[model samples]
Target: MADSFLRPAVSTMRSGIAGALIAVLALAAAPTIASAQTAAPATKPAAKPAPATKPAPAEPAKDAAAPEDPLPWIKICSKDADKKNVCLVAKELRSQEGQLVASVALRDIEGDSKKVLLIAVPPVVLIQPGMRVQIDKGKQLEAKYTICFPNACYAEMEIADQAIAEMKKGKALVVTSLNIQQKPMAFPFLLSTFKKAAEGEGIDPNAGQQNQEQLQQELQKRAEEAAKKLQGGDAAKPADAPATPAPAPAPAEAPKP
Candidate 1:
């Protein structure tokens, strides 16, 4: 009976120690398991994209209109103090300095079949050689120097109907003269509007006087533009003064013999 009681007590003590060990192990592992379950998940990185290219610029558009003519042919009609009708189809060219380069006119008198081609040139030319005029490559005509004024020397020739017809159909009227240096100088006058101007009615006697201011303004504008172009469009510098016109001859004054 004593041996049986001792064996039962020893077995009861071993069972209690094993249960305590199992409880301690479960308590230690509880925190690690809870942390793992509540923690956030890691994220993957995004891929990079390529850059875009830019487009090129466009070009400017061109102008379509034609340029205007600087000098144009004109016809003038007036009565002299003597009460005689005088009509002239004329063109004049001048230098930037306001000096006259050359002037050509076809003078017509009422009740007269004879028409005169009057030309005025600078006094620096040789009067002995006279003047030569040609329409394009056609026949050349000779004109004699009739008189010399302070500003210009005059030359005149009688023009026939045939010459007028030829001039109407010509492209240019070329006037050749010998300079003081004995070198030949040529002046080409455009005949593009010659036919129309010759056939058209003459403007009033006061028309030129009325348009003088406008003409001066146009000349001034052109001079300014030319200067700007030469200076590479620099507008700070002022342009030179426009040239003054020389006094025109009276309509009644014909070339002397």
Candidate 2:
């Protein structure tokens, strides 16, 4: 009786243990199914793009108004050399009637250091009497025409130290030139600040400005002085002035007549 009871009880216990093990396995499989149904699907990684390029900067806007030019009266320039400040002084001359007549440039000549005046006249003007520059009714500096270009006639003159001194110290300069008619036209170059212009390598255009009436007066005064000097030299014979030598008496004609 004891064996029969024990065998049935043990069989029932084994059945119960097998069902528990099956239940645990099913519970583990249920979680896997739930995860597969609810979880996000995997996909290939997106390709990285090439490095982006930078955009070019925008350009500045152009000005609307036309650009202004530098002063038209004069220009100063320097050349490259061992000496740092070797420069040229330049000026443009215009007529009272608003015509461009001439240009003048000055420089201290190398080696000798003499001042040189390079005068450029209009091509249409006469080259005779060459070109003359004087300071405040002072003695004239004359130079013969050396070249003629399509645009201008050029005369270069070495200025004496005395003349340069006078120019630097004087009030004005008178530039005389012959026109196409061979008439003398005097241009009074105002030298109000010439010293500053030469040393500083530039002229104050306003410093040299003169009115027409003032120019006319200066021209008249210069003309009168020039005329007086001419007349005085020709007519005013000093008492001790040597007389003109008389021509030799005609040779005595042979008595054949």
Candidate 3:
């Protein structure tokens, strides 16, 4: 009976031990299985694009690049101009045919209104490099100008002084037909800075304005002198003044009555 009991107890102990060993083996393999599953790398997401940069600002416009004014017109048909129907712009500096310094256009006012002269220069004129500026054509200039527009005159070449003298001996003025630089319109662009050059040549368009102040002073002086004379006033003479000589007899003396 004792041996039977002992044998059954030992067998029960062995079964418990076997069950514990199986549990230990399963725990040891659990980590390996987990590692195998983790070894497969994860799918990466697509990278986002970088932000765009801002653009720079634009540049400013130029001012001094403007063209020149036209040649001042010769005044015609004005009482101030001796009532002549034809006006003339005389050349102070003679221009040679190929000397090519500057070119100019003419703008004349038409009718009663005081505004920029409306006119055009034909492209036939070979004007020198210049600017085109607007000027008011008063009635003093003439009935109107011959060439007038935004840029009626185009490309003018300048000639040398010596060449100009040579041409003048032959009595010729290098006149060019009108042309356009970059457009279809017949506007006068300055082949040369004729107006600015004219200033250096001693033409003063502001003479009228200057005359007002000068004339006033002159008139006042004349009036004072006249008033003194009319009132029988005599300028104080110096005590050291020389004696006045008697008037000489006429070259051909007439017989007195």
lDDT by candidate, in order shown: 0.63, 0.52, 0.29
Alpha-carbon RMSD, each predicted model: 52.5, 54.3, 52.2
- Give the per-residue lDDT digits (tens) of candidate 2, residues 1-257: 00110011211112232233233223212112122223355455569856657656645544343222111224254444655434455554433222234456676534547677777655555776687888877888887888775645677888777886787777556666786788775544455455665766442333333332244355456557877899999987689978899999999988985
Superposed model 3: Cα runs more than 4 Å off = 1-46, 57-79, 82-188, 191-257
For candidate 3, report its TM-score.
Answer: 0.19
List of clashing residue pairs for candidate 1? none
The TM-scores, one per candidate, come to: 0.60, 0.45, 0.19
- Residue 28, candidate 3: how far off, in angstroms? 98
Provide the lDDT at 31 for model 2: 16
Better of 1 and 2 by TM-score: 1
Give the number of the best model, judged by TM-score. Answer: 1
Give the worst 10-residue stretch by lDDT in candidate 2.
Answer: 1-10
Query: Could you tell which candidate, 1 or 2, scores higher by lDDT?
Result: 1
Q: Model 1, residue 47: what's the lDDT?
A: 81
Number of backbone-clashing residue pairs for each candidate, in the order shown: 0, 0, 43
